[model samples]
Target chain A: MVRFEDISTPARLAEPGEGIGRDELSLATRNHGLPLEALRYDLTPPGLHYVLTHYDIPYAEDGDWELTLGGHVERPLRLDMDELRSYAAVTTRVTMECAGNGRALLSPRPVSQPWLVEAVGTADWTGVPLRALLAEAGVRDGAVDAVFTGADHGIERGVEQDYQRALPIETATGDAPEILVAYAMNGAPLPPQHGRPLRLVVPGWYGMAHVKWLRDITVAAESFTGFQQATAYRLRQEPDEPGEPVARIAPRALMVPPGFPDFMSRARVVRPGDHTLEGRAWSGHAPVTAVDVSTDDGHTWNPAALEASDDHRWAWRRWHFTWTAAIGTRVLCARATDAEGRTQPLEQPWNRGGFANNLVQRVPVHCTGL
Target chain B: MVRFEDISTPARLAEPGEGIGRDELSLATRNHGLPLEALRYDLTPPGLHYVLTHYDIPYAEDGDWELTLGGHVERPLRLDMDELRSYAAVTTRVTMECAGNGRALLSPRPVSQPWLVEAVGTADWTGVPLRALLAEAGVRDGAVDAVFTGADHGIERGVEQDYQRALPIETATGDAPEILVAYAMNGAPLPPQHGRPLRLVVPGWYGMAHVKWLRDITVAAESFTGFQQATAYRLRQEPDEPGEPVARIAPRALMVPPGFPDFMSRARVVRPGDHTLEGRAWSGHAPVTAVDVSTDDGHTWNPAALEASDDHRWAWRRWHFTWTAAIGTRVLCARATDAEGRTQPLEQPWNRGGFANNLVQRVPVHCTGL
Candidate 1:
C-alpha cells in the first residue's frame, strides 16, 4: 500500500486501533477490490462491492477523530463526526476504480500492492460536498489546492508520513464529477473497512483522490507537492519524471449476470441453444456511448441493449448481448466506447502503476451438449 | 471439467484418485493452469508448470496402460509402458498453452473452466516420437486421420463415453512441431497431476490436442467427429457454424525476469534505474519471426534481443529488452510475429470457444524511488 505522505511536518504517529490479523486476512481483509464475478448483477450489493485502499483501514473513535478546515480559509473550523452530521446530507451512487486496476497484466509490472482486474466497485455515497464545506470555511483568495489528510499513515518508499493527497481547488469547488465527504456507504453507516466516520469520494478520479478516513481539509496557496501528488499515482516516462498525476477512471464497462462465480471462471457450461449475456458499463470521464460483444473472438461485434440512463454521471449503465451456444467451446468478449469515443483497447496502455487497464473483456464458454 | 465421452461403447467408468472435496475445490484442485506471474521466468519449473485436465487425474497403473496401434496399418501392435520405453527416446523442451489461455478476458466469457492468461507453461518432455511409432506400425493406404483415445472418461453434456480426439495423419507422422507420447516431465516420472502412465504432447497446439492417459491410436480414412474434436475446442461464429477447429499455439510471447507474483500483480514496482527485461516467445504454426517491446504503450516499439536460433521448432526462444525505468507508473508491452507474418492482433480476433488468445502482453511497473 502506497500511503501518500506529507513529510514537511513531523509525522503524525499512528494511533492504536484494530489491526487486521493474519487469520482474518482475505482479499477483503486487504481491502479487496470488487471480484469480477461479483459483477454478475445489475445493482451491486453493498457487501459484494469492491474496495481499494492505500493503507490499512484506520479505526476511528468519534471523540478522537475530527474534520478540520484550515490553511488559506478565512474561518478555520473543526468538527467531530457528530457535529459534522448536522449539515444537510445528499446521496449519490458512484463507481470508483483504483488507478492501478489491471496492473498485473502489464509487462514489467510496476511495484506496489500487486493488483489484478478487480480494484473497482460502486456504492451510494451519503454526505456533504466539499463545496458546502469549503463555503462554510470561507476560502480566501489564491487557494490553489485543497490538501486532504487521512487518519491512515505509514512509511512509503523509505519515507515516513501520514496519508494525504490534494485536489486542485477548482475540482473541490466544481459540481461535475462531484466531490463528497461521505459518512455513509450504500445507505448504511460506513464500515471500518471502508472509511468509517468520513472519507473523500471523488466520483470521477481514481481511488488515490478519495482520501479515506479523512481528518482534515486544508485550502493551500501553492500546489501541494506532497509525495502522492508529486510522486505516487502518476504516469511517468522515466524514473525521475513525475509524469501526469493519475486521475479520473477511464472509459470502460463490466457485466455481471447471474450464475458467474465470485472469481473468474473459464466459461459457463450451457446446453446447446440460444443464450443472452448481459452486464454494465460506465466511464468516469464521459458517458458510455456504446457497449459491444463479439461471439467470434472480435472478428465481429454486436451492439448490446442498454438500459435507459439517468442523470447520475458516475453510475454504470446495464447492457445485454444475446447469442447462441453451439456444441463447443466459445469465447465471448465485450468492449465499450465513451461519448468521446474512448473505447477499451485490445491491450490497456501500460503505466508504471498499472493503472486504468480498460482492455476489452473476453469470456469463454462451453456448449457441453453434443 | 469437460471430459470427452464415447457413448459408442459402455463408458470407461471413472476411477477416483484424490477426488477434490468441496473444501478442496480451487483453481489448483481442478487441475489449474499456470499463473500468469509464473511466466516472469523463462523455463517453467515442474512445480510451477501449468496443468489442464478435462477430468480428474485418473489412476493409471503402468501395468494397465499401454499404447495400441491399429486400423489401416500393416502391423497392429500394442506395447506396455516398459516395452514402449525400449525404443529410442528423445528429449525436447516445449512450451504448451491452453487454447483457452485468455478466455476470461473475453466478454460474455464462454462457459467452461475459467482460465485467465496463465494457462500456459514450458517444460522438458521425454518420450518416443509418434512418427517413429507410426513407422513401426507401418501406414496402410487410405489413412487420413490418426484417431487417438485416452483412458479418462465421463458423461459430458449427458453422453457417456471414453475420452477421444484425432489429428490429421500427416501431422501424426510429420517432423516439425513434433508429437510425442511423453512419460516423463523435466526428467522426472510423470506425476498423476499430469498424465500418469503416458500422455500425448502435441507441442504448439492447445492442451486438448495432448490427449492424456493414452490408450489407443487408430489410423482412419476420414476426419474424426468425436465431441472434443468436432464440437469442443472449436472457434465458432454461429452455433451451427463449426467455425474452425483451434490448432497450433498461436504466436505469443511472455517475459518476467524475476521478483514477480505467481499471478498477475498490478505492476512490478522497482527503484528508478536501468533494468534488463527479458522472457520467452513461441509459435506452433511458424517460427517466431520477430518480437517487439514498447515502453510507451504501442506508440513506438523497439525490437528486443532474441536468443540464437536452433533446430528445435517448438522450443520458445528467449529475448531481452534493456531500458531505463523512470519514476511513477510506466507501461511495458511486448508483441510477437511468426514466420508466416502472423503477428498478435492489437486484439485477438474473437471466437466462441475463446481459443487462441495470443494477444500482446502489456506490463505495468512503478518506479517507486522518485
Candidate 2:
C-alpha cells in the first residue's frame, strides 16, 4: 500500500541540515489516507506517479461491444470489441498532464484544488491504432471530423449531463499512431475510474478531449459542438483584453515552453552543510534537451544528466545534482530546456487565468551551518 | 422555451435546382446552416444565439452575493452584487466563437463535437470593467496571474471537480477596459445557464477558460495547476509532426486562423437580372483590411463595401456587393484579407487535431429562370 507518510515530501524543500517545520512536515505526511504503492526509480516513484484515464474501465464481460464507423464514407462497418483487439496491438509509453497544472499558484488564487505541482504523470499504454478501424470502415474523402462521446454523467444547469467532445477528422484517422482505442494502462487492466471498455488515447491534448466512459464514435463532414466543445473546455478570456465578452479560444497545439524554472532556489536552512539538489523536468511537446544546475545562485551552472525513458515522447526525465557548501545560507537552482529550444523563464507573464505556468519555480530552503 | 426546431431555417439556399439525392442534400446542409434572421443584425439573437455560463446560475436567493478583495493590500473590502451592479456598465458588439468552430472540416477529423458551422455568435455584452475592481482592491506588484474559479462541478474519478482556470496578471489589470466582470447578457439578467450572479468575460479566447461559477479570488507570486490545468484542457499531440505521440504535444498559446472560404460569394434570386452578393469578413488576430467578392466563382472579383466598428479588436464587420446573375447555375465565392496582409487560402494544411480551420468557405447556390 502507498503510505503518504513514507513518501510525502514537503511541498517546499527544506534547506540542508535545517529542521523541517512541524506544520509543513505533518501536512506533507497526511495521506488522503489512501492505500497506494511506491514503485521507486531514480525519479518519480511508480506508485505515487500520475495516471490518465480516457474511458471507464470495461471488463471482459462487457465483451460484446461494437465500434460503428459510418458517415461521410464509402462503406460503414461495425466491429465488436473482440474484433478490434484482434488487430495488431501496439503499446507505447506516454506522459499525460492536466492542462491547468499550475493554476493554483496564480494570483487571486482562482477557486480550485490549487494543486501545488505533482498533477502530471507518465505511463505505458497498450491499445489498437484507430487508423486500422477507420480503414476497415472505409472512410471517404469528404470526411471532416470525428466525434467521441463518453458515459460519465454530471450536473449542468441542475440537469444531469454526459461528458462528450470531438476531434477533427484528420486527427481521428491520421497516419500518426498516437490515436489509440486503448484497453490497458501500465500493463494492467484499466482501473475502474479510468475508462475500461475502450478509451481514446490522444497523447497531446488536454484531458477534456480524452473522454471517459466512451460509448460512441461518429465520423462526419462537420465538427461536433456539444456542451464540452462549445461551452466547456475552452479559454473564456481574450489574449489582449481580460475583460471582454467570453470568446471561444482555440485549442493551441501543445509545445514545450521556452525554459524551465529553478524549483530549488531561495532555499534556507537553520543548519548548513554540503547539499544535493533535485528536481523534475517534463514537456507535453518535446523531449528534455538538457538540464542545468546552479549553485552560487545564478552566477555559475553545471549540467545534470537526465534519466533514460522507455518512450522519449511520453515521460518526463528527472535530473539531480550535488553542491558543496561551507557557509551560512545559499540559494540553489535548476533550469531545464526542451529539444525545441524552449526554456522556462525566470517569471511568466501575468494572465487572468493561469493556463500555462512554466515560470522559474523557486523553493525556499533555510540552511544552518553545522 | 428554447426550441431547436423553431430556430432552424428552411433548406432554401442549400438545395440544387434539380432534384438532389438525400445524401447530397444532407451533406450540403451539414456543411452549411443558414442563420434564421440573415439580414436582421443585432449582434446575438435570442433564438439563434450562444450562451456561456459560470456557476449553474447561483441559486436565486442565495445568488445575492458580493466580491471580496484582500491580500497584500491597504484595505480589505467587499463589493456586494447590488452595489457592484451599480457601477457603470459598457456594452460592445463582439463576435464569440468556439476555438473548435471549423474543427470538423479538418481531414482525419479530430475527436470532438460535430459542430455544424453555427458555433459563432455576435452580441453586445454589458459589464463593469475589471480594472475598477482592481483599483478598488489596490493591486500590488509581484502579482503574477489572476485565477478564476466557477461553481460548475462534475465527478471525475470520484473527485468533485470544479471548473477553474487563470490568466496573466497583466491581462487582468491591463489598460484596455474591455475586460469585464459581467452581470448581464444581452440586456437581461444572465440566464441561469449563463453565470447569473457574476462571470468573467474575456474576448477572443476559447470558451473554456472563462470560469462559469466564479466564487473566490486569490493573489499569488505564482500560478495554480489543478486537474483542469494539468489535464482537461491541454493538447497532447505533437504539433510539428504529422503524427507523433499525443503526449509529445505541448500546450501553447491559442492561434486563430484567418479568412473564410468563398466568404465574399453569395447568390440571391432577385428578378433574374441583377442581384446583390454579400458576406461577413473579419479576423481573430488582426482587423479586416479588405474583402473581394467573386460572382463567377474565382474567375474575377470586385471589392465589397466594408462596414466599420468602433472597436475593431473585438468585433467583425459586415461587407456586401452587387452582381448580375445569368439564371441557370453559377458559383459564387468570397475572400478576405487582414491588416497584416494575410489573405484567405483555398485550403489549409491538414493537422492531426484540426484546431485552426480558416480555409476559404464555398457555398454554391442555383438560380432558376424567373
Per-residue lDDT tens digits of candidate 2, residues A46-83?
A: 22333322211222334665666677776786767677
Could you say which candidate leads in TM-score?
Answer: 1
| lDDT (0 to 1) per candidate | 0.69, 0.49
CA deviation > 4 Å runs, candidate 2: A1-370, B1-39, B52-63, B68-77, B155-160, B226-271, B296-300, B310-313, B328-331, B349-353
**TM-score of each prediction:** 0.49, 0.40
DockQ of 1: 0.02
Residues B1-370, model 1: lDDT tens digits = 3433321122111122212111112232233444343455455644345666564345466777778999989999999989988989988878888888766455645544445466677878889999999999999988999988887654454444577989999999997667898998878777665677798998878788988888899999888998888877787866678678888888887766222211112224556678888777888888897889888866799999888657667777888888887666667788888899988876656777778878777665655563
Q: lDDT, candidate 1, residue A291?
A: 93
**Candidate 2 chain B: minimum summed lDDT over ten consecutive residues — where?**
B257-266
TM-score result, candidate 1: 0.49
Instruction: Supply the global lDDT for candidate 2.
Output: 0.49
Interface Cα RMSD of candidate 2: 29.5
DockQ for each of the predicted structures, in order?
Answer: 0.02, 0.01
Q: Which ten-residue region of model 1 chain A has the weakest summed lDDT?
A: A20-29
